[model samples]
Target: MGTGYEPLEVLKPVADDIWIVDGPEIRFYGMPFSTRMTVVRLSGGGLWIHSPIKLSLALKARIAALGQVKALIAPSVIHYAYLTDWKHAFPEAEAWIAPGVERRAERHGIPLEFDHYLAGANPDWAADFDWLVVRGSKTVAEAVFHHRASRTLILTDLIENFEKDKKPWWMWPILRATGIAAPNGSMPRDMRMTFRGNEDLLREDIERMIDWDPKRVIVAHGRWFEDNGAAELKRAFGWLLDG
Candidate 1:
Protein backbone atom coordinates (compact mmCIF):
# COMPACT_ATOMS: atom_id res chain seq x y z
CA MET A 1 0.00 0.00 0.00
CA GLY A 2 2.09 2.89 -1.27
CA THR A 3 0.42 6.28 -0.76
CA GLY A 4 3.41 8.19 -2.11
CA TYR A 5 3.50 6.85 -5.68
CA GLU A 6 1.83 8.43 -8.72
CA PRO A 7 -1.92 8.63 -9.17
CA LEU A 8 -3.84 5.81 -10.75
CA GLU A 9 -3.68 6.36 -14.49
CA VAL A 10 -6.73 6.85 -16.73
CA LEU A 11 -7.56 3.71 -18.64
CA LYS A 12 -6.48 4.05 -22.25
CA PRO A 13 -7.55 1.74 -25.04
CA VAL A 14 -4.71 -0.20 -26.65
CA ALA A 15 -6.46 -2.43 -29.18
CA ASP A 16 -10.05 -2.32 -30.56
CA ASP A 17 -11.78 -2.75 -27.21
CA ILE A 18 -8.80 -3.57 -25.06
CA TRP A 19 -7.58 -1.05 -22.52
CA ILE A 20 -4.55 -1.34 -20.23
CA VAL A 21 -3.48 0.59 -17.18
CA ASP A 22 -0.12 0.64 -15.45
CA GLY A 23 -1.86 0.35 -12.15
CA PRO A 24 -1.30 0.72 -8.37
CA GLU A 25 1.92 -0.26 -6.68
CA ILE A 26 1.88 -3.16 -4.31
CA ARG A 27 4.60 -4.10 -1.85
CA PHE A 28 6.24 -7.37 -2.79
CA TYR A 29 9.52 -9.10 -1.85
CA GLY A 30 9.97 -6.37 0.79
CA MET A 31 9.66 -3.56 -1.76
CA PRO A 32 7.04 -1.83 -3.90
CA PHE A 33 6.29 -3.42 -7.28
CA SER A 34 4.30 -1.80 -10.09
CA THR A 35 1.18 -3.50 -11.44
CA ARG A 36 -0.75 -3.63 -14.72
CA MET A 37 -4.37 -4.46 -15.53
CA THR A 38 -6.07 -5.28 -18.84
CA VAL A 39 -9.74 -4.76 -19.59
CA VAL A 40 -11.44 -6.23 -22.66
CA ARG A 41 -14.98 -5.57 -23.78
CA LEU A 42 -16.42 -8.88 -24.90
CA SER A 43 -18.70 -9.42 -27.91
CA GLY A 44 -21.80 -9.32 -25.73
CA GLY A 45 -20.85 -5.89 -24.42
CA GLY A 46 -19.72 -7.26 -21.10
CA LEU A 47 -16.44 -6.36 -19.42
CA TRP A 48 -13.80 -8.98 -18.70
CA ILE A 49 -11.19 -7.79 -16.20
CA HIS A 50 -7.90 -9.64 -15.96
CA SER A 51 -5.36 -9.43 -13.16
CA PRO A 52 -7.47 -6.74 -11.49
CA ILE A 53 -5.88 -4.01 -9.42
CA LYS A 54 -7.62 -2.04 -6.68
CA LEU A 55 -10.84 -0.31 -7.72
CA SER A 56 -10.66 3.31 -6.60
CA LEU A 57 -13.67 5.67 -6.54
CA ALA A 58 -12.64 7.37 -9.80
CA LEU A 59 -11.65 4.13 -11.49
CA LYS A 60 -14.96 2.60 -10.48
CA ALA A 61 -16.84 5.52 -12.06
CA ARG A 62 -14.88 5.31 -15.30
CA ILE A 63 -15.37 1.55 -15.45
CA ALA A 64 -19.12 1.93 -15.01
CA ALA A 65 -19.31 3.78 -18.33
CA LEU A 66 -17.58 0.89 -20.08
CA GLY A 67 -20.25 -1.83 -19.74
CA GLN A 68 -21.30 -4.36 -17.17
CA VAL A 69 -18.33 -5.78 -15.27
CA LYS A 70 -19.53 -9.28 -15.91
CA ALA A 71 -16.39 -11.32 -15.48
CA LEU A 72 -13.64 -11.07 -12.85
CA ILE A 73 -10.51 -13.18 -12.98
CA ALA A 74 -7.54 -13.98 -10.76
CA PRO A 75 -5.13 -15.33 -13.37
CA SER A 76 -2.83 -16.90 -10.79
CA VAL A 77 -2.48 -17.32 -7.05
CA ILE A 78 0.12 -14.55 -7.08
CA HIS A 79 -2.32 -12.20 -8.90
CA TYR A 80 -5.20 -12.43 -6.46
CA ALA A 81 -4.29 -9.53 -4.16
CA TYR A 82 -7.03 -7.22 -5.44
CA LEU A 83 -9.74 -9.66 -6.55
CA THR A 84 -11.59 -9.22 -3.27
CA ASP A 85 -11.88 -5.48 -3.76
CA TRP A 86 -13.21 -5.79 -7.31
CA LYS A 87 -15.65 -8.52 -6.38
CA HIS A 88 -16.88 -6.41 -3.48
CA ALA A 89 -17.51 -3.49 -5.84
CA PHE A 90 -19.22 -5.47 -8.58
CA PRO A 91 -21.09 -8.16 -6.76
CA GLU A 92 -22.77 -9.41 -9.92
CA ALA A 93 -19.51 -10.02 -11.74
CA GLU A 94 -18.77 -13.72 -11.98
CA ALA A 95 -15.43 -14.49 -10.31
CA TRP A 96 -13.33 -17.07 -12.10
CA ILE A 97 -10.46 -18.84 -10.35
CA ALA A 98 -7.32 -20.16 -11.93
CA PRO A 99 -6.31 -23.76 -11.44
CA GLY A 100 -4.26 -24.51 -8.27
CA VAL A 101 -5.23 -21.13 -6.80
CA GLU A 102 -8.20 -22.13 -4.71
CA ARG A 103 -6.01 -23.99 -2.26
CA ARG A 104 -3.08 -21.62 -2.52
CA ALA A 105 -5.18 -18.51 -1.93
CA GLU A 106 -6.83 -20.07 1.09
CA ARG A 107 -3.51 -20.99 2.62
CA HIS A 108 -2.37 -17.42 2.16
CA GLY A 109 -5.58 -16.12 3.84
CA ILE A 110 -7.03 -14.72 0.63
CA PRO A 111 -10.29 -16.68 0.93
CA LEU A 112 -10.91 -16.46 -2.82
CA GLU A 113 -14.32 -17.55 -4.01
CA PHE A 114 -15.11 -18.45 -7.58
CA ASP A 115 -18.19 -19.20 -9.65
CA HIS A 116 -16.09 -21.12 -12.17
CA TYR A 117 -12.54 -22.47 -12.44
CA LEU A 118 -10.44 -21.77 -15.53
CA ALA A 119 -9.41 -25.20 -16.78
CA GLY A 120 -11.03 -23.99 -20.01
CA ALA A 121 -12.98 -20.93 -21.04
CA ASN A 122 -16.38 -20.37 -19.56
CA PRO A 123 -19.50 -20.15 -21.75
CA ASP A 124 -19.76 -16.42 -21.09
CA TRP A 125 -16.21 -15.62 -22.23
CA ALA A 126 -15.30 -18.66 -24.33
CA ALA A 127 -16.56 -16.98 -27.49
CA ASP A 128 -14.23 -14.06 -26.92
CA PHE A 129 -11.06 -15.77 -25.64
CA ASP A 130 -9.03 -18.98 -25.78
CA TRP A 131 -6.98 -20.38 -22.87
CA LEU A 132 -4.12 -22.68 -21.90
CA VAL A 133 -2.58 -23.81 -18.64
CA VAL A 134 1.16 -23.23 -18.02
CA ARG A 135 1.40 -26.45 -16.08
CA GLY A 136 5.06 -26.82 -15.11
CA SER A 137 6.29 -24.62 -12.28
CA LYS A 138 5.82 -26.00 -8.79
CA THR A 139 5.89 -22.49 -7.34
CA VAL A 140 3.93 -20.53 -9.95
CA ALA A 141 1.15 -22.05 -12.04
CA GLU A 142 -1.09 -19.79 -14.12
CA ALA A 143 -3.64 -19.68 -16.93
CA VAL A 144 -2.72 -17.76 -20.09
CA PHE A 145 -5.45 -16.10 -22.14
CA HIS A 146 -5.79 -15.07 -25.78
CA HIS A 147 -8.25 -12.29 -26.47
CA ARG A 148 -9.34 -13.34 -29.96
CA ALA A 149 -11.29 -10.23 -30.84
CA SER A 150 -8.26 -7.96 -30.54
CA ARG A 151 -5.52 -10.50 -31.24
CA THR A 152 -3.86 -9.78 -27.88
CA LEU A 153 -2.46 -12.40 -25.59
CA ILE A 154 -2.69 -11.75 -21.81
CA LEU A 155 -0.30 -13.41 -19.41
CA THR A 156 0.23 -13.08 -15.67
CA ASP A 157 3.64 -13.98 -14.27
CA LEU A 158 4.81 -16.47 -16.91
CA ILE A 159 6.44 -13.54 -18.68
CA GLU A 160 7.59 -10.39 -16.91
CA ASN A 161 8.81 -7.17 -18.62
CA PHE A 162 10.01 -5.14 -15.65
CA GLU A 163 11.98 -2.06 -16.67
CA LYS A 164 15.04 -1.35 -14.57
CA ASP A 165 14.72 2.44 -14.43
CA LYS A 166 11.12 2.29 -13.27
CA LYS A 167 12.06 0.14 -10.30
CA PRO A 168 13.53 1.39 -7.03
CA TRP A 169 17.31 1.46 -6.64
CA TRP A 170 17.32 -1.45 -4.24
CA MET A 171 15.61 -3.63 -6.80
CA TRP A 172 18.29 -3.02 -9.41
CA PRO A 173 20.69 -5.66 -8.11
CA ILE A 174 17.86 -8.13 -7.50
CA LEU A 175 16.43 -7.44 -10.97
CA ARG A 176 19.80 -8.17 -12.54
CA ALA A 177 20.14 -11.32 -10.50
CA THR A 178 16.64 -12.42 -11.51
CA GLY A 179 17.20 -11.47 -15.18
CA ILE A 180 13.92 -9.52 -15.47
CA ALA A 181 15.23 -6.03 -16.20
CA ALA A 182 14.20 -3.84 -19.12
CA PRO A 183 15.00 -4.17 -22.87
CA ASN A 184 15.41 -7.93 -22.78
CA GLY A 185 12.71 -8.89 -20.28
CA SER A 186 11.57 -12.46 -20.75
CA MET A 187 10.48 -15.46 -18.75
CA PRO A 188 12.16 -15.14 -15.38
CA ARG A 189 15.19 -17.34 -14.77
CA ASP A 190 13.62 -18.62 -11.56
CA MET A 191 10.49 -19.67 -13.43
CA ARG A 192 12.40 -21.12 -16.36
CA MET A 193 14.62 -23.17 -14.10
CA THR A 194 11.55 -24.68 -12.46
CA PHE A 195 10.20 -26.07 -15.74
CA ARG A 196 12.90 -28.79 -15.52
CA GLY A 197 11.34 -32.04 -16.75
CA ASN A 198 8.06 -30.45 -17.85
CA GLU A 199 9.65 -28.64 -20.77
CA ASP A 200 7.59 -30.45 -23.40
CA LEU A 201 4.24 -29.63 -21.77
CA LEU A 202 5.11 -25.93 -21.42
CA ARG A 203 6.55 -25.82 -24.96
CA GLU A 204 3.40 -27.35 -26.42
CA ASP A 205 1.33 -24.60 -24.80
CA ILE A 206 3.70 -21.86 -26.00
CA GLU A 207 3.55 -23.34 -29.54
CA ARG A 208 -0.22 -22.98 -29.54
CA MET A 209 0.12 -19.35 -28.38
CA ILE A 210 2.70 -18.67 -31.11
CA ASP A 211 0.24 -20.11 -33.61
CA TRP A 212 -2.27 -17.45 -32.54
CA ASP A 213 0.23 -14.92 -33.89
CA PRO A 214 -1.02 -12.26 -31.54
CA LYS A 215 -0.66 -8.67 -32.65
CA ARG A 216 0.45 -7.68 -29.15
CA VAL A 217 1.14 -9.38 -25.86
CA ILE A 218 0.30 -7.95 -22.41
CA VAL A 219 2.53 -9.24 -19.68
CA ALA A 220 1.72 -8.40 -16.03
CA HIS A 221 4.77 -6.24 -15.44
CA GLY A 222 7.00 -3.71 -17.23
CA ARG A 223 6.51 -2.67 -20.89
CA TRP A 224 4.19 -4.90 -22.90
CA PHE A 225 5.09 -6.17 -26.36
CA GLU A 226 2.97 -3.94 -28.56
CA ASP A 227 3.99 -5.57 -31.85
CA ASN A 228 6.05 -8.54 -33.03
CA GLY A 229 4.39 -10.27 -30.10
CA ALA A 230 4.50 -13.69 -31.69
CA ALA A 231 8.24 -13.58 -32.19
CA GLU A 232 8.81 -12.08 -28.74
CA LEU A 233 6.69 -14.74 -27.12
CA LYS A 234 8.57 -17.45 -28.96
CA ARG A 235 11.83 -15.88 -27.88
CA ALA A 236 10.81 -15.26 -24.26
CA PHE A 237 9.99 -18.87 -23.63
CA GLY A 238 12.81 -20.08 -25.84
CA TRP A 239 14.23 -22.14 -23.00
CA LEU A 240 11.16 -24.38 -23.01
CA LEU A 241 11.08 -24.76 -26.80
CA ASP A 242 14.04 -27.11 -26.76
CA GLY A 243 13.56 -30.74 -25.69
Candidate 2:
Protein backbone atom coordinates (compact mmCIF):
# COMPACT_ATOMS: atom_id res chain seq x y z
CA MET A 1 0.00 0.00 0.00
CA GLY A 2 1.08 3.59 -0.47
CA THR A 3 2.86 4.93 2.59
CA GLY A 4 4.69 8.05 3.77
CA TYR A 5 2.05 10.39 2.38
CA GLU A 6 0.61 12.99 4.73
CA PRO A 7 -3.08 13.89 4.82
CA LEU A 8 -5.08 16.84 6.18
CA GLU A 9 -2.03 19.09 6.14
CA VAL A 10 -1.89 22.84 6.48
CA LEU A 11 -2.39 25.26 3.65
CA LYS A 12 0.74 25.90 1.60
CA PRO A 13 1.42 28.62 -0.88
CA VAL A 14 1.71 27.59 -4.52
CA ALA A 15 1.97 31.11 -5.93
CA ASP A 16 1.00 34.67 -5.16
CA ASP A 17 -2.43 34.63 -3.50
CA ILE A 18 -2.83 30.90 -4.14
CA TRP A 19 -2.85 28.29 -1.40
CA ILE A 20 -3.71 24.59 -1.20
CA VAL A 21 -4.69 22.27 1.63
CA ASP A 22 -4.10 18.56 1.32
CA GLY A 23 -6.94 16.35 2.54
CA PRO A 24 -7.42 12.79 3.70
CA GLU A 25 -6.86 9.73 1.56
CA ILE A 26 -9.97 7.94 0.38
CA ARG A 27 -10.75 4.89 -1.70
CA PHE A 28 -12.48 4.68 -5.04
CA TYR A 29 -13.05 1.35 -6.69
CA GLY A 30 -11.01 -0.13 -3.84
CA MET A 31 -8.00 2.02 -4.69
CA PRO A 32 -6.38 4.53 -2.39
CA PHE A 33 -6.67 8.07 -3.65
CA SER A 34 -6.26 11.50 -2.11
CA THR A 35 -8.01 14.87 -2.46
CA ARG A 36 -6.95 18.52 -2.29
CA MET A 37 -8.51 22.00 -2.17
CA THR A 38 -7.26 25.16 -3.83
CA VAL A 39 -7.70 28.68 -2.43
CA VAL A 40 -7.25 31.84 -4.38
CA ARG A 41 -7.16 35.29 -2.82
CA LEU A 42 -9.10 37.63 -5.03
CA SER A 43 -8.06 41.12 -5.97
CA GLY A 44 -10.77 42.49 -3.69
CA GLY A 45 -8.91 40.89 -0.79
CA GLY A 46 -11.63 38.27 -0.49
CA LEU A 47 -11.13 34.55 -1.04
CA TRP A 48 -12.40 32.21 -3.75
CA ILE A 49 -12.21 28.57 -2.78
CA HIS A 50 -12.13 26.05 -5.61
CA SER A 51 -13.16 22.45 -5.02
CA PRO A 52 -12.95 22.83 -1.23
CA ILE A 53 -11.66 20.05 0.99
CA LYS A 54 -12.62 18.98 4.53
CA LEU A 55 -12.43 21.91 6.96
CA SER A 56 -10.68 21.71 10.28
CA LEU A 57 -10.84 24.45 12.87
CA ALA A 58 -7.14 25.15 12.45
CA LEU A 59 -7.38 25.35 8.68
CA LYS A 60 -10.46 27.51 8.96
CA ALA A 61 -8.59 29.98 11.17
CA ARG A 62 -5.68 29.94 8.78
CA ILE A 63 -8.00 30.84 5.92
CA ALA A 64 -9.76 33.52 7.96
CA ALA A 65 -6.44 35.22 8.46
CA LEU A 66 -6.04 35.37 4.70
CA GLY A 67 -9.34 37.03 3.79
CA GLN A 68 -13.10 36.73 3.84
CA VAL A 69 -14.30 33.70 1.95
CA LYS A 70 -16.28 35.50 -0.74
CA ALA A 71 -16.90 32.73 -3.21
CA LEU A 72 -17.29 29.03 -2.48
CA ILE A 73 -17.43 27.19 -5.78
CA ALA A 74 -18.18 23.62 -6.73
CA PRO A 75 -15.99 23.19 -9.77
CA SER A 76 -17.94 20.07 -10.76
CA VAL A 77 -20.38 17.54 -9.36
CA ILE A 78 -18.02 14.98 -7.88
CA HIS A 79 -16.01 17.73 -6.16
CA TYR A 80 -18.83 19.27 -4.14
CA ALA A 81 -18.96 17.14 -0.99
CA TYR A 82 -17.23 19.76 1.15
CA LEU A 83 -19.25 22.68 -0.19
CA THR A 84 -21.83 22.60 2.58
CA ASP A 85 -19.19 22.61 5.27
CA TRP A 86 -17.56 25.75 3.95
CA LYS A 87 -20.97 27.35 3.27
CA HIS A 88 -22.00 26.84 6.88
CA ALA A 89 -18.70 28.29 8.03
CA PHE A 90 -18.90 31.25 5.71
CA PRO A 91 -22.61 31.71 5.12
CA GLU A 92 -22.10 35.07 3.46
CA ALA A 93 -20.00 33.58 0.71
CA GLU A 94 -21.64 32.97 -2.63
CA ALA A 95 -21.94 29.28 -3.48
CA TRP A 96 -21.52 29.27 -7.23
CA ILE A 97 -22.47 26.26 -9.34
CA ALA A 98 -20.82 25.09 -12.52
CA PRO A 99 -22.56 23.95 -15.71
CA GLY A 100 -24.73 20.83 -15.31
CA VAL A 101 -23.70 20.71 -11.63
CA GLU A 102 -27.15 21.10 -10.11
CA ARG A 103 -28.61 18.05 -11.81
CA ARG A 104 -25.58 15.92 -11.05
CA ALA A 105 -25.63 16.91 -7.37
CA GLU A 106 -29.35 16.21 -7.18
CA ARG A 107 -28.90 12.80 -8.76
CA HIS A 108 -26.07 11.95 -6.41
CA GLY A 109 -28.21 12.73 -3.31
CA ILE A 110 -26.15 15.82 -2.52
CA PRO A 111 -28.59 18.58 -1.59
CA LEU A 112 -27.23 21.94 -2.67
CA GLU A 113 -28.50 24.98 -4.58
CA PHE A 114 -26.48 27.41 -6.54
CA ASP A 115 -26.85 31.02 -5.54
CA HIS A 116 -25.54 32.02 -8.94
CA TYR A 117 -25.12 30.02 -12.13
CA LEU A 118 -21.75 30.58 -13.81
CA ALA A 119 -22.42 32.03 -17.25
CA GLY A 120 -20.64 34.56 -19.45
CA ALA A 121 -18.85 36.65 -16.85
CA ASN A 122 -19.10 37.19 -13.13
CA PRO A 123 -19.04 40.87 -12.28
CA ASP A 124 -17.36 40.23 -8.95
CA TRP A 125 -14.42 38.20 -10.23
CA ALA A 126 -14.74 38.40 -13.99
CA ALA A 127 -11.80 40.75 -14.27
CA ASP A 128 -9.53 38.08 -12.83
CA PHE A 129 -10.68 34.91 -14.58
CA ASP A 130 -11.67 33.29 -17.83
CA TRP A 131 -14.33 30.65 -17.30
CA LEU A 132 -15.42 27.78 -19.56
CA VAL A 133 -17.76 24.83 -19.30
CA VAL A 134 -15.94 21.71 -20.52
CA ARG A 135 -18.46 20.07 -22.84
CA GLY A 136 -18.74 16.71 -24.67
CA SER A 137 -18.94 14.61 -21.53
CA LYS A 138 -22.16 12.63 -21.36
CA THR A 139 -22.04 11.95 -17.61
CA VAL A 140 -20.24 15.03 -16.26
CA ALA A 141 -19.32 18.63 -17.00
CA GLU A 142 -16.56 20.71 -15.37
CA ALA A 143 -16.16 24.44 -15.14
CA VAL A 144 -12.55 25.45 -15.70
CA PHE A 145 -11.09 28.68 -14.38
CA HIS A 146 -7.94 30.49 -15.42
CA HIS A 147 -6.67 33.05 -12.93
CA ARG A 148 -5.32 35.91 -14.96
CA ALA A 149 -3.39 37.52 -12.14
CA SER A 150 -1.55 34.39 -11.12
CA ARG A 151 -1.37 33.06 -14.64
CA THR A 152 -2.71 29.79 -13.28
CA LEU A 153 -5.39 27.53 -14.67
CA ILE A 154 -7.60 25.75 -12.15
CA LEU A 155 -9.45 22.52 -12.89
CA THR A 156 -11.20 19.99 -10.72
CA ASP A 157 -10.87 16.72 -12.62
CA LEU A 158 -10.01 17.33 -16.26
CA ILE A 159 -6.41 16.14 -15.83
CA GLU A 160 -5.00 14.06 -13.02
CA ASN A 161 -1.25 13.72 -12.28
CA PHE A 162 -0.97 10.77 -9.95
CA GLU A 163 2.45 10.02 -8.47
CA LYS A 164 2.66 6.26 -8.73
CA ASP A 165 5.12 6.04 -5.90
CA LYS A 166 2.79 7.84 -3.52
CA LYS A 167 -0.17 5.57 -4.24
CA PRO A 168 -0.77 2.13 -2.78
CA TRP A 169 0.63 -0.92 -4.51
CA TRP A 170 -2.79 -2.30 -5.33
CA MET A 171 -3.74 0.93 -7.10
CA TRP A 172 -0.98 0.69 -9.72
CA PRO A 173 -2.91 -1.54 -12.08
CA ILE A 174 -6.10 0.53 -11.88
CA LEU A 175 -4.27 3.83 -12.18
CA ARG A 176 -2.26 2.51 -15.11
CA ALA A 177 -5.42 1.14 -16.70
CA THR A 178 -6.98 4.60 -16.37
CA GLY A 179 -3.84 6.23 -17.88
CA ILE A 180 -3.34 8.50 -14.87
CA ALA A 181 -0.64 6.73 -12.86
CA ALA A 182 2.20 9.25 -13.17
CA PRO A 183 5.19 9.25 -15.55
CA ASN A 184 3.17 11.86 -17.38
CA GLY A 185 0.33 14.01 -16.15
CA SER A 186 -2.57 13.72 -18.51
CA MET A 187 -6.32 13.35 -18.71
CA PRO A 188 -7.53 9.94 -17.65
CA ARG A 189 -8.90 7.56 -20.27
CA ASP A 190 -12.13 7.15 -18.30
CA MET A 191 -12.75 10.88 -18.45
CA ARG A 192 -11.82 10.83 -22.13
CA MET A 193 -14.61 8.29 -22.65
CA THR A 194 -17.04 10.82 -21.25
CA PHE A 195 -16.10 13.06 -24.18
CA ARG A 196 -17.13 10.32 -26.64
CA GLY A 197 -18.38 12.16 -29.73
CA ASN A 198 -17.88 15.62 -28.34
CA GLU A 199 -14.33 15.82 -29.58
CA ASP A 200 -14.80 19.03 -31.55
CA LEU A 201 -16.59 20.80 -28.71
CA LEU A 202 -13.91 19.77 -26.23
CA ARG A 203 -11.19 20.75 -28.64
CA GLU A 204 -12.70 24.18 -29.09
CA ASP A 205 -12.49 24.76 -25.34
CA ILE A 206 -8.89 23.55 -25.22
CA GLU A 207 -8.04 25.96 -27.98
CA ARG A 208 -9.54 28.78 -25.97
CA MET A 209 -7.41 27.75 -22.97
CA ILE A 210 -4.32 27.88 -25.11
CA ASP A 211 -5.10 31.50 -25.83
CA TRP A 212 -4.97 32.31 -22.12
CA ASP A 213 -1.31 31.17 -22.03
CA PRO A 214 -1.16 30.16 -18.41
CA LYS A 215 2.07 29.60 -16.46
CA ARG A 216 0.74 26.94 -14.10
CA VAL A 217 -2.20 24.49 -13.92
CA ILE A 218 -3.63 23.21 -10.66
CA VAL A 219 -5.73 20.08 -10.57
CA ALA A 220 -7.80 18.66 -7.72
CA HIS A 221 -6.14 15.26 -7.75
CA GLY A 222 -2.55 14.07 -8.06
CA ARG A 223 -0.05 16.77 -9.13
CA TRP A 224 -0.29 20.11 -10.84
CA PHE A 225 1.90 21.61 -13.56
CA GLU A 226 4.26 24.14 -12.01
CA ASP A 227 6.32 25.22 -14.98
CA ASN A 228 5.70 25.35 -18.70
CA GLY A 229 2.07 24.93 -17.82
CA ALA A 230 0.75 25.85 -21.25
CA ALA A 231 3.14 23.52 -23.00
CA GLU A 232 2.18 20.71 -20.64
CA LEU A 233 -1.50 21.41 -21.23
CA LYS A 234 -1.08 21.23 -25.00
CA ARG A 235 0.91 18.05 -24.66
CA ALA A 236 -1.64 16.45 -22.38
CA PHE A 237 -4.61 17.27 -24.62
CA GLY A 238 -2.76 16.41 -27.81
CA TRP A 239 -5.37 13.80 -28.64
CA LEU A 240 -7.94 16.46 -29.46
CA LEU A 241 -5.46 19.13 -30.57
CA ASP A 242 -3.69 16.89 -33.10
CA GLY A 243 -6.91 16.07 -34.87
* Candidate 1 TM-score, C-alpha based: 0.92
Candidate 1 global lDDT? 0.80
lDDT, candidates in the order shown: 0.80, 0.81
lDDT of 2 by residue, 7-81 (tens): 465777889888777887766666666788888889877999988887888888988888899998887777887
lDDT score for residue 19 of model 1 = 91
- Cα error, residue 46 of model 1, in Å, equals 0.9
Note the residue pairs that clash in candidate 2: 2-168
- In candidate 1, list every pair of residues with a backbone clash: none
Q: What is residue 218's positional error in candidate 1, in angstroms? A: 0.5
lDDT by residue (72-139, candidate 1, tens digit) is 98888788877878888899899887877788877888766578887765556778887877777776
The alpha-carbon root-mean-square deviation between model 2 and the true structure, to one decimal in Å, is 1.8
